[model samples]
Each structure stands twice: as structure tokens, then as C-alpha cells.
Target chain A: MKALDSFNPLAVFVYFMASAGIAMFSMDPVILLLSMLGAVTLFVIRREGRQTGTHLFSLFLFLTLTVINPLFQHNGRTVLFVLNDNPITLEALLYGADAAAMVVSVLYWFRSFSSIITSDKLLYLFGLLSPKPALMISMALRFVPLFRMQAKRTDMAQRALGKYKEDNAIDFIRMKLSVFSIMVSWALENGIITADSMAARGYGTGRRTCFSPYKFRPQDALLLGLSLMLAGAVGAAMALGGLEFAFYPTVSKISPDFLRLAAYIAYALLSFLPATIEIGDALKWQYLRSRI
Target chain B: MKPIRNEKLRRTVRYLVPFVLAPGFVALGITVFHEKRYAFISLCIAVSAVALFATGFDKKRTGSRRLVIVSVLTALSIVGRFIPIFKPVTALTVLTGMYLGAESGFLAGSLTAVLSNFYFGQGPWTPFQMLSWGLLGFLAGILAEPLKRSRVLLFIYGIIAGALYSFIMDVWTVVWYNGDFSIKLYLAALVSAIPYTVSYVVSNVVFLWVFAKPFGEKLTRMHIKYGI
Candidate 1:
């Protein structure tokens, strides 16, 4: 759990921003596969032997998205099959797979992102710009989980009172609505109390001082520099058309070039840095324990 | 009291920022530039619009309080997404808009998307969700008087908002599939997405029917009590 959290917030934020950005922007299948591998590896390491059943739904979504594209889109030269006079092409199927990989990889990255970057880190990143909205965002993040708990509490109380019998769909919805309204009023009253407390504490009364637990250490700076350099190399390659692929007219073959290969390596390394770090750390701990 | 010299500037910004932000950044980012930098730029625009609306639309004295209210509303919308199929995010955003100003509504709606995507997933489609929901909230705020007075108008607006959200998302889907927007492909995408769109409309209407009146009354009472 503390594996990725050990890094500075700035480092984690930059890594994700760069990785997710590259994953979304790059259409090259090789780059997309690399990003997906990195994301899945990091997700596994982060969960640390936990059941991976949670990602099955996203996988199902990926398969559906992948299959839907080729069916709806009839393009490319190589016809795989014809259904209802619509030609299904290999290029379209490949393109669909590529897009699905991109989406699923981005989703996996976000799954790790929410776990690594807590509300405090998010506020710390945004608070530098405007403290009020930053505070609001952090408060909103806090209240999400709080209100979920409140909803459960209300549900239990209503059930105990024999008021929330789920006999029919309409009755169940009505019961939920009543719980929601109770939560709404509770949230509103909570807001007033918070606002009064903030006002009394002289919030927003001049320059705001923020206290952050994250520090930009030398290692953090090193990680930031490394990620930026790798991202810059990949971006330069992309701009130079070294990473372009088109599938609609025909599946264009990518002749492996030195520059493109180098860019791919750099991008792969950049994405895999976090997972590599966690694995390396775990190995070191294991080695030390065995020696002792 | 000294006369504020930036009154004209503030007034111009009050309208100009949202205009430039809601359409300009998102459209250009999606249609024109396929670069990674544009994605970051669009995100910045969305965040700035939220900040501007939170601060620029209200008096300074009430700013923090408004922020608190918007935050809570955003939180509620996020939690509202957890209630299975009939999500109340749209209803809550509209309620916020009807009670608060358009800017507050937009902020609440957009922030709700951004925040909840933390749990759902973040991708290129996130900004579009923010823009669509934010615009719905903004429009609701503009028609607040009528919406407050007429339940029928509110319901109609809810229906439209639901469809609008689906339409915007379909645009994303088409663009994502084809790598460029095409009318033919878009129509096909719309046809495929019909079932999802219908569900969106039904959920919006059902949730709004259930949640709006009770939520609105509480917000009104809070507004009168705290003058926020």
C-alpha cells in the first residue's frame, strides 16, 4: 500500500500526467501496448496479492468496445468477412483493438492514480493557484466518502424502523429517495457549520498558508527530470511523425526505424518507472530479510 | 468607500471567461490539435472556469461560504452517482443551478464530473462530460426563475439535459472511433447509442422527479437562513 505512496506527490503527479497523457495521445499500437503493460503491472504491484476480480468489468467493457468498432465501421482493404453486405476488414478490427487497449490502459492508470494521489496531494497541487477552490475540491473529496457512510447509516436506521421494505421497484426507489433527501439536508447543515468554522478561523483573509507533508527531495527531482526528458523525447518523435499509424484506408506497415525504436524504448521506460521502483524495493526488502 | 476601477474588466471577464472556456478550449482541443499539450491546456481551461465562477461571480464576503456550499453540492452529486442505475447527478447539478447562480451551478456540475471520475475513470472523455454537465447546470441557472416557478419546465429541462449529455458523449465516441468527426459515422454512432441515451433520459427524469423538490426546498431554506 505504501509502495507508490513513498514517492513525493509532485513525482507521482508528474509521472501520471506524463504517462496518461502519452497513453491517450499516441495512436501507435506498440506504444499503446507498452502503456497497457506498465499500467497492469503497476496495478498488480499496488494491490499486492489482492483479488483482481474488480478489473473484470473493465475488461468486459474493453472487449465490448473492441468488438463494436469493427461491426459499425466498414473500412480498409483486407476484407475478413461480410455480414449483411457490410465488409468487416482486418484493419478495422486492429484499429478497434488499439482503441480499446488505449481506453483500458488509461482506466488502469487512473485506478492506481486515485490510490496514490490522495486528497491532500490533490489539494497541495491545486492550492498553489487558488486556495479557496483548492480547499473546496479537497472538501468535496472528503465529503464523498463521508456521505456514502451517511447513506449507509440512514439505510440501516430506516430498515430497523421498518420503513424501507423493498417490496417493489417504485417503493425501493422511494425509500432511497427519502434517504437521499435526509443526506441532502444533513450535507447542507454540515456545510453551514464548516463555513462558520472557516470564517471564525479567518480563512480567505489575506495570504493563505498551506501545510504540506510532501517535500521535493533530490530523488523526487531526479524522477521528475527523468520523466520529463523521456516524455520530451517521445513527444519529439511524435511531432516528427515517427509514431503515426492509420488504419481506415489501409493498415499501414510501420517500418522499424532507429529513431522510432529509441522513442518507444524511452516511452516504455517512462511508463514502467513506478512499477519498477516498487518491485525493486520489494526485492531489496526480501533480500535483507533472508540475510537476517 | 473607494470606487472599484476594474468594474468593467470584471464585468467583461464575468461573461467572456465562461464563453471562451466552455466552447473554445474544448472544441479546439478535440477538433484542431491532437497534441498532448492541448489536452493539458483544455484541463487548465476547465479548472480556471471553475475557479473564476467560484470567485468572480460573487462578492468577496460570501465567496468562501459559496465555495463551501458548492463543494457540498458537488460532493452530493458524486455520492449520488453511487445509487445504482438512476443516478441523481444531473438533478443535483440542476438543483444547485436553480438555487445558486449559473456560475455556481457550472462549477458544481463540472467539479462533480472531475471528482467522480477519480472513482470511475479519467480519459479524453472527461472534459466533455465536465462541459456537458456544466452547461446543463449553467442553463438551469439562467432559467432558474422559470424552473423554480414551474415544475413542468424543470422536468422538460431535465429531459433535454439528459439527451444533451448523451449527445455530447456520442460525439466523443464517434470522434474516438474514426479519428475525425464524420456526419455519416456520427449518425451510425447515434443509432448504436440509442439505448444508452434512452436510459440516460429515463434516469434523469426519474431521479429529478424524486429528488428535485425536497432538495430544492432545503437549499432554499439554507439560502434564506444564511443569505448564501
Candidate 2:
């Protein structure tokens, strides 16, 4: 539910990544579509809807993508229209829909990931791989919002000075060059300070341990087992060619059709792990609250 | 004269601090992780690492106001890169050239291309990014003195520049994707590229509108200080 309350960012990350990996080789378009839908739904359900702007724009964008993609790619058997010299096919539209679904789905996965799995969780999970790489990622992610804030403050201060007035090309050029020079210095100083502060904390040294709020209880283990089962089933389905379908000629030709359907179900279930856990946590917390 | 020189060096350091460290590590991770042909990733790492290591180059005092102005311009330029109108590299290059002169433009333009990849994925285009953005900055410096007019003049220049920007990126993509000289793919790419190509232009135009005069004024103030 919250980054602070998560067992391991790695668990969630591994699940989504595995699903994405599975989705890529999915023989049945139906399976891919379900996984895509599953990812979006998870995205919607997560983050406490704090940054609603991104969510709103994401909806509009996904809709536009769905509508417009088919118009551009007119290469399919079932012609939806014959405009002048070209034919618009149902296949192309469907294909576009698929692509749109894929893109939006991926974006949704990323959004949910950022919300539920903050840097700390991610670091705790993957930090063992390499200290330098982990620190760099954490620092960069942390810097984005900070840099944006700093840039604003700097702008305001400069604007207040009334020094931002120059005439003619040569003078204008001269003025901006100096401005850039100063900004760069500010950035470097900030960076050095951050790096120094981080280093002083003994960050990447000697048997690194992370304190997790959520303990690995029985339910967590059960969830983990279920997750593994679902993942395995999904993989088995894809390898058997269960969920691959194309719309160019007609909806035809994907292998192990029954197995593919089973795989899709497993994939969908697997994608819902975070949502399920968060909701379960929310309910448990609410129940405890209600009891109290 | 010696006092002025020391002052200038300090000012230069003040300007370069952030640009050096932030993307420097990014370039390094990218260098080691994603190994591919062209040693492009290594080049990126080298450029940013070199820049970062040089942070101690200046110890002179730089006016915070001057830093503020460049910060605004740089931020706007980064936002411009996201618009997908003109190629990010081209808009960055042109902007660098127009405001910062040849040398600075070159660095800014190239750095933008490499740095912006932090948002998007980095791949074979890293070298091309350096070249394209750097060249745009170089060209901007060349054209800076004469171009003074309304938004329309800028828009026109941006469009032309956007087209040129697309040309280079497309050429590179063809090489990266191992695309043969197929008229079909070319036609598809050319037509499809309009949004991305024009985005650079539209965004740069927007950026120019918002920050141009303010940034220009600040730079001139700094130049006056540094005797550049």
C-alpha cells in the first residue's frame, strides 16, 4: 500500500518484469490484452491518486492512441473503408488498438511501480548487486524533483535583481552565456554537497542491512507461493505458444489455445499481486481501526 | 588583470558545477551497463566524467543572479527536448549556438542530447546525439549575431532546423536498425516523423518565447563581469 510498508520492492519489480517478459512472447493477443488491462487497473488502484494530473493525461493519451493508431496503419485484410486510393482495414485498427494498449499498459506499470516501490525499497531489494550502480540510480531519481525546485528558486532570485535585461544580439548572447555558467556552478556545488553528505553516512559499506516495516508473515509466504505458481503457469503457457494472435488477415492462428487461456488467467492474476496485497493490507488496517 | 582573470575563472566554475556532476554518474552507469558497438556509451561516460572531474577548475566568485538566468534557460531547454517537435538535439544545438556562442553551444548541445537520454533509453544514438546537439549549438553560435526578429522568424528557422535535425537522426536510425534503402520505410519514417521532428521546433519556439530575453540579459551582465 505504501512504500514504507512493503516487504520487498524486488518482489513487485520481479513480478511486473516477469509479466512484461512473458507478455512479449505471448502467442495469443488475447493474453497480452488481458495483461495490459490488468496493468492499467493496478495503476489506477495504486498511489492514493496523489498526482492526478498524470493519471488524467494518461487516460486521454491512451484513448487518443487507441483511436488514431488504426488510421495511420492500413495494412490488413478486412477493409473498414476505401478512401480515395487507400483502404482502411479492421486489422490495422485492431493492430493499432493492440499497440496502444501495449504502450499505455507499460506506462501504467511504470507509474504503479514508482508509487509503491520508492528508491529505498528498490535499493533494499537490489542494492546487493553493486553499491555504485545502486547509489547512482537512487541519487539520480532523488535529484530530478530537487533540481526542478532549485531551478525555480534561482529564477525568482535572479528576476528580483532586475539584472535580466539586455539589448541587442551581442549583449544578449553575452548575458545568457554568463547565466549558464552560473547555473552549472550551482548544480555542481549541489551535487558535491549531496555526494559528500551521502558518503559521510557510511552508505555503501560493510554488511548493509535494511529495516522493513512489513515482516514476512505466513500470509506473505502464501502470497509469494501463489505468485510463483502464477508466474510459472504464465511462462509455460507462452512457451507452448498459447497466447499469440494477429489481426492482419483475421483473428487466427495461436497455439495451445486452451493452455493459452489458462496462461492469460495466470498472468492476469500475477499482475494483480501488488494490488491484492495493498487492498488486503488496507482492509486489515481498516478492520483493526473499526475494531478499535 | 590578474585579479580579473581569477574572478573570471571563479565565475566559470560557478556556472559549470551542476552540469558536471548530475549527468556524470548517469553517463558512467550507462557506459558500463549497456555495451554496444561504436563505444558510444564509453564516450558518454568520458565526456561527463571529464566534465565532473573538472569541477575544481574555478574558484572565483560568480554572481548568483547570473547563475539564476542560465538555470532558467537550461531548465527550459530540457523541457523543450521533451516536446518531440524538432529533434531534441537540433533544438538544443540551435539554442546553444544562439545564446551561448560557439564553444559553450557545442558543449551544451552535445550534453543535452546525452543527458536527455536519461528520460528515454540510451542506445546507438548516443554518439549521434552528441554530434547533432553539439552541431546545433555550433550552428546557433554562427547564426546568433544576425537573427533578431519576431516569433515567426524563429518559427521558420526552427522548422528548417527541425527538418535538418530529422535528417541526421533518421540517417542514424537507419544505420542502427540496419534499415536498407527502402523507399517504403523511408516514406513511412519521413511522414511519421513529423510530430517528433516538429516537436523540437515548437518546443524551442516556446522556450525562446519564455526565457530568451531574460536569459540573454543575464548572460550579457555576466559577460560584462567576465570581459568575454
Candidate 3:
């Protein structure tokens, strides 16, 4: 199995949730920086960093979020300049940048998350919690593709029947509306049929059991344990106020103490863990290939 | 088919879960996780509320056909969201609510937000989006009669839904930025969000005006014919 695939979905889910949660909740620059680095590293490693468009979009989001915070918020003391007779202070700007970093890092983490956690994995996770929602998700996912194909066919048939000319904006909207209504009626009718078929096959009649190929091996356990421990460290730091960084009226100093240093290191290790595994896995495969 | 064992119990569960638990979670987030993590905590509350709402629609009571129909509507709404400009998600959801009942409408709206986000990319904003859209459809379901009786009222309701959607989302924006709700910041967010809100209102009105008659007829026919 591939190194990334070797980890169970549950383990991966836990790791991402913990990583993204810390990134979302914490305002500390050190933690945010580590999160950004880790997320970017994973993206680069997994996708080979070829997705320029999304990178640009992320940068744009970061810039907009960073700039927008200072305009409305005027609580800071260190005055940078005045726009419209309002002092745009350094504190608000710094807070904006920090908030932007937090948002962007979380975004990156989720992007990686979407890539790693496939629908089947999500279904598996959800099935463990609640079966009905999982079934609904599966059904919805199934219908999305089916409906797309049906919509295409419906559009083609409508055009062949001379139903819509689409010569103007009004005509275009009319065509879309006609097609959508047709799909709804068609889907509702077929959905009943689908349900009848399911009923015949004994759905919702007996105890439900979910089948998944994933096994909780030693590596999965190890990964899950490591993530939980690291996340616990960060949570403890948060509870103890070791991770606090205030930026309201004035900026507070980030004095490095033992607990703060330990929390930072723990978060750094946690964030980099996935990328480290990826790198190690790549090197190991290369060594094996060379020996062969 | 087994009927709902206790209608009163189900109703209590349906109402209490979202109302009681959502605020309880927010309280927990504020006290335990601190104000800094309020957004994250609220997100948790949103997810749980959606999940609880979904679970309340038991397959035995609603039947598998209703579930399938809800899923189909959700898929359609997700696809509608992808259409260039002027999304019909709200119009479609409102119709679903008007015909299928409030629970299904809530399911379709919330599911559309989440499942579509799978393609558009999920973020901290996702749960809030789900809740907002879900609320619109739920309210539409509650006011289905008045909305159906008069075209003018339906259009006005559509406009109100758009504004309501924007209002809830502004709540998310303020909470996310400040880590707590402040009235002044919320007002600023609402003002700055006017253009987007107008667009939301327009799209809802436009789509409803265009598709309501045709789609409403189809849904009405299906409900009568198939008893779905």
C-alpha cells in the first residue's frame, strides 16, 4: 500500500481535525506560521505544487482579509496613518494579518483534507456516528452524477423539439427553467421507483452493518496516538493561557517561557507530522527501488 | 410500516435538539474553550444541529421514497449553485419546503450547502452557510400556505428569505472576526454586505418568479399522484 494510504481514514480524520482546530482557534503567530508551512508542504508534496490558480486565489483571499480588518476596527493605539480622518493603527493591521494567516492556513488544511478524505472515507466516518446521514450522503452523491447526465439529455431533447431558441438572455433563462422543472418532475417520479426497488431489497428492515476495507493496524494506532497527544499538549497550553497573544488596545509581548516553548514545539511537530511521513515514505520507496 | 412510536416524543426531539443543544454548545465553547474559539464552537453546534435534524427524519416514519426525493432535490440545488450567476438554490429549496414539508426543505438546503462545498471547498464558513440556507427553507415550509396562495406574497417572501440569509451570514462574519458578537461590528458588516445582499434578494426573486409556477405544478402533481 502507498504510505499515505496505509493510515486509516479515522486516523487521518483525527489528525486533520486536530490540526485544523488548533489552527482555527489559536491566534499565536508561531502556531499560525507552522500551520501555513505544514499545509503548503503537504500541498506541494501531494500535488507537486502545480495548481497556480488556487494558490493565486488563496493569496488574494489572504490579502483581502488582511486589508479589510483595519478599515472597520479602530481600537488599536499605535497610529500608522489617517484615511478619512481615522487613524489606522499598527495593532489592527497586525491583528488583521494574524487573522488572515489563520483563515488561509485553515483553508489550506481543508484543501488538503478534501483531497485526502474521499467520499467513501467520509461515509465510513459518518457511518460510525450515524447511519442515516451517511446513507443520505451516499444517495445524494449518487444522484448528482445521474442528474447531471439526465440534465444534458433533457437539454438536448428540448433543443431537438424546438422548445427553446436561446437567442437572448430571456430565452436562455427560459430554457434553463424548463429543463430544471423537467428534471425535478422526472427525479421525483424516479425517486419513488428507486425507493420501491430499495424496499423490495429489504432496506430499513433489519439491523444495518457497514463494510469497510480499512483495518486499524499498528501504524494507524501509532498515528492516531501521536496526533491526540500533540493536540492535547496544545489544548493544555490553551487552557493554561500559555498560548495567549493579545492585540486590542495595544500589542502584548510574547515572552518565551518554558510552557510556551513546549507548546510551540508540540504544535510544530504536530503540523509537520504528515509532511514528514510523506518525505520518509518517498525516501524509503526510492531506497527499495534502488536495491531492487 | 411502523408508525412513529410516539409523536410527542419525536416532536420534542425535533424541536429541543436544535434549540437547546445549539445554545448549550455555544455556552460550552465560550466558557471552556474561551471566546477565541467561539467560532469553532459555533461550528460544532451547527453541525450537531444539522445532524440531529437529519436524524429526526427517520426512514420508517418518512419512508425511503421521501429520503430519495430529498436527496434528489439536494443534488439539484447543488447543481443549481454551480450555474453562472443568479443561483437558484434558494428558489429550489423554497419549492422543496412548500411541497415536501419543512423537514425535507431543511434537509435539502443544508445538504446542498455542505455537499456543494465539497466541490467549492469547505471552510469555517460552511456550517454557517448550511444553517442559514436550512433556516430559509424551514421558514418557507412553515409559511407554505400563505406563500402558495398569493403570487405577491410569495415574491415578498422570497425577498425576505434573501435578506434573512444575508442577516444570518453577517452574524457569522462578526462572530468569526471579533470572536464574539458585537452590535456595532454587526451593523458595519450588514452595511458593507448590502450589495451582496441585494444580489441574493434579486436572484431569489428572479428564480422564484420564473420557476415557481412550473416547478410548483410538477411537485404538486407528484405529491398527488405518488402521495410522496
> Model 1: residues >4 Å from true position, as ranges?
A48-63, A145-183, B1-61
Write one digit per residue (lDDT tens) for candidate 3, span A1-292: 2366667899998999999988888888899999999998888788833479878988998998888778878879899999998889899898888888888888899888887777778777766655666678888899989999999999999888886676878788788777877888788889889999999999988755466778888888888999999999988888787888889889988889988999999999999999989899999889999998
The CAPRI quality class of candidate 2 comes to incorrect
Expressed as tens digits, the lDDT of each residue in B46-94 for candidate 2 is 3443333223211222233322233333444554456443433455456
| iRMSD per prediction, in order | 7.3, 15.1, 5.7
C-alpha local distance difference test of each model: 0.78, 0.54, 0.83
Candidate 3 Cα misplacement greater than 4 A, ranges = A1-6, A48-50, A162-176, B1-28, B35-37, B182-184
Q: DockQ score for model 3, please?
A: 0.42
Q: What is the DockQ of each candidate?
A: 0.36, 0.04, 0.42
What C-alpha lDDT does candidate 2 achieve relative to the native structure?
Answer: 0.54
Positional deviation of A243 in candidate 2, in angstroms?
2.5
lDDT per residue, candidate 3, B77-189, as tens digits? 88888876678899989988998899888888987887888888777788888888888888889999998999899999899999999998888887776666778879988
2 versus 3: better DockQ goes to: 3
- Model 3: clashing residue pairs? none
